[model samples]
Target: MKKYVRGLAIVGVLTLAVAACGSKPAENTAGGDANKDFKACMVSDSGGFDDKSFNQTSYEGFQAAVKAKGLTPVKAESKSDNDYPTNMTAMVAAKCNVIVAVGFKLEDATDKAAKANPSIKFAIVDSAPATPIENVKPLSFNTAQASFQAGYLAAGMSKSGKVGTFGGLKIPPVTIFMDGFAEGVRYYNKQKSKNVQVLGWDDAKQAGLFAGGFEDKAKGQNTAQNLITQGADIIFPVAGPSGLGGLQAAKASNGKVNAIWVDTDGCVSAAEYCSVLISSVKKGMDVAVQDAITSVVDNKFDNKQFIGTLENGGTSLAPFHEFDSKVPAELKTELDTIKADLIAGKITLESKAQPKAS
Candidate 1:
């Protein structure tokens, strides 16, 4: 059977079976509608909930799960990394039963919070603690797998024979996308005997351009423009909301350039740039978030890490939306075959950033 692929809008489906482990009922809260009083809380990274990328998608899943279980929902938005600990503390004080801290940046804070409160269950997205804690669950995604497909798509579609990708920061989660994209371009070149150049990232050197943070749109725009000036027609920005600037750069190019978004479907999250986007590399953060919440509601929460991958419907390529008709059918078929190959272990990736097996 083929693996499942999900976009940002279809997050309502609770299809995170591959990522979540089977849970055993909790000793203390096993019966009598635990969900009614169960509190699901979340603390966002610096990007806040409307980022149209990571935070937004995760928040959507969190909200969906809370609504489905009729549980109380509470959220805290961090203005910067400094706020992680404070916000986490606030969630704890709110008497939350389960707390999820979004982003790798919050790993330290989440760890501290989890350690300080043994009674509360905690989960952190995109990061794992240095030392494992019995109460903290890790929610991670192997985006490199899906990003490889996206890289190949960009290479196959690039009219200039040059495609580029940049990141918000030089972190594992961010660079995982870059590494796969660069490798995919190399793979395409080897397969087709075509020298399609990739700018912004070099997997061999493990070096590339970065926007320094996930919030600066102008910086994202400038960085993308730099790639464009180098003759790249397809730009993939792995930055969060900052990536919207890359789309703005593409839009300014008129018919000369296009882009691929990261984390969520650009067509739905950043619709203004839909005309310029070929597709998006989507992470099923929402699905995983809901699954985590559900486990709590069922009184079966565990600390095992949840790693999303192409095989599990966790990470996938978004539909080609406005470019659906424009994307050659042959290319689409090739992508499907590539996805199957990856899922079946016929193909493998070299990204060092892939989540460690649990």
Candidate 2:
């Protein structure tokens, strides 16, 4: 009878252990599960993933999403615009649950891929989805606001009382930054009752703007030099890889000139010219990517546009870095005030499409 009781007790203990194991949460699994195997993929624009600007920012966001959601991620770097469709299609074929296509250059390809793969979720950065497919989400940034702060800084710091702005292309996103920079300078001049002038891309005409046609460092360098010759001591280069030219120009100018970087933190990325970089207009791609991944993991992914603005912490000015000591405390306080006013709608930074110049 004692022996029989011992056998029954051992069976009861084994049954309890099995029941507890079976009741464990899905998230606590040792190797994860089928649902956790969801794959996210990103395809870069012609600039590739290491342009150190928009492309790099978007790629970081995608990576953030992947890591947060415990998702497997695949990346396809396009060498040119022609490769967008092929790369996007390859990701779909690889069973990617979500596809992120970076840049306006990939708009057409993204549209086509999203249409062909109705079941796959799509996120297009820097461009809106044409058809508003059920699974498509468009992400855009209010870069103008951040650029405005940069303009304010440039205007205040300018020894020549003149600032210059340029971009790789005259696209909406690029021009928006230029417009904000110009307007910010104008705003500063109006507020301080100064006469600081801004050149390149007339906010009204949106024309007469210099476009190096993307990624030609030489053209960017030439443009910066011309602006400097015209008495511009501060330059804002919104161009991609081409913006490096402006940095180079600033360096060669013997510390008489300075510049503002775009997208990523130029202080770290452009160490050679860190001394000349007042600050960078940063877009919070990392946070956005992480949020998207979390949404996917929670099965709450939605098809809508995500806007990164100052209010949302999606975009802002990078640290002053080496220039911190040079920036006046009053100027910093004034900048903060301006930022709050802009967010509160007390001050408006115009974002209307600039009229074409005759």
Candidate 3:
């Protein structure tokens, strides 16, 4: 048996990435309202609007709605957890038509504000708190499905026979991607009878490397370097902005390593890192946010949960851009077959980290 040298980067190794909820309000108004001042406001997580991941995509969708429906746009950018409630309350005090919270960090704040301001429609990205307030809708995804494919691709392409994954935090939203990634590597090992190793995470134990927060690029870079030093040639970062650091690590490796991105295609979202990105496990937050705005425009805002799964085109593996020729034809065919199997219910992934089907 090949010896497994395990080293876990757990929480608290660096600054505690707790979501402390008030900060200055950053607002955006994209032209005056053409829809009778149908105001739409959004509150970003600590990742800010330029995180180049979830927050960016969510805001982009909101911006798209502002242009498409001629709606008044309002936005508040949070620098920390403190800013979440502060931003939401300000938007509520303004009595905006709809307020979107950009991440799971804002779920608690969003819940309190939504209940207090029942007249306002609320949307939360990446979190569905157990208590369902009629006014707040959750925009979530089973991103694990897509991540599994990325893991398989990494395993198939790795000459080192070692791939790695890590997250900004240990939260379910981030861990779901890691869980699927590790499992996919295991599945690939089984199918190919190869000794491919996933360095960062252990699915059964639900323990692995975490940078403790998403905002620190240095931490992400170090985490990727750690995995690479341990023989990982492919790194999948489930962190938002921190993922950019991992991309930097990979790019600096001079062909020594490649990376898989999360939330949105790094090829486009973080185009600077495309050369190092193998692919991305994308969640359709842009599409979901746009749909939410459309629903409001149609005056049919319900608190129903919007679950993004592969079957719904809400989550998917991106095209193997620079790696198109590098991936074996057989491997690509296998991925398609696996995708079909997953959608057809012939295969099921077991993960407590996925969104609860309510």
Winning model by TM-score: 3
- Evaluation by lDDT, superior candidate among 1 and 2: 1
lDDT of each: 0.81, 0.72, 0.79
Could you tell me every candidate's TM-score relative to the true structure? 0.90, 0.86, 0.91
Q: In model 3, where do residues sit more than 4 Å from their true spots? A: 1-32
Ranking by TM-score: 3, 1, 2
Worst 10 residues of 2 by lDDT: 1-10
Stretches of candidate 1 above 4 Å error? 1-36
Instruction: Summing lDDT over every window of 10 consecutive residues in candidate 3, give the lowest-scoring window.
Output: 4-13
**Pairs clashing in candidate 3?**
20-81, 20-82, 21-81, 21-82, 22-82, 22-83
lDDT of 1 by residue, 119-170 (tens): 9988777876666788987888999989999999999999999999999888
RMSD of 1: 7.8
Worst 10 residues of 1 by lDDT: 1-10
Between candidates 1 and 3, the TM-score winner: 3
Residue 113 accuracy (lDDT) in model 2: 82
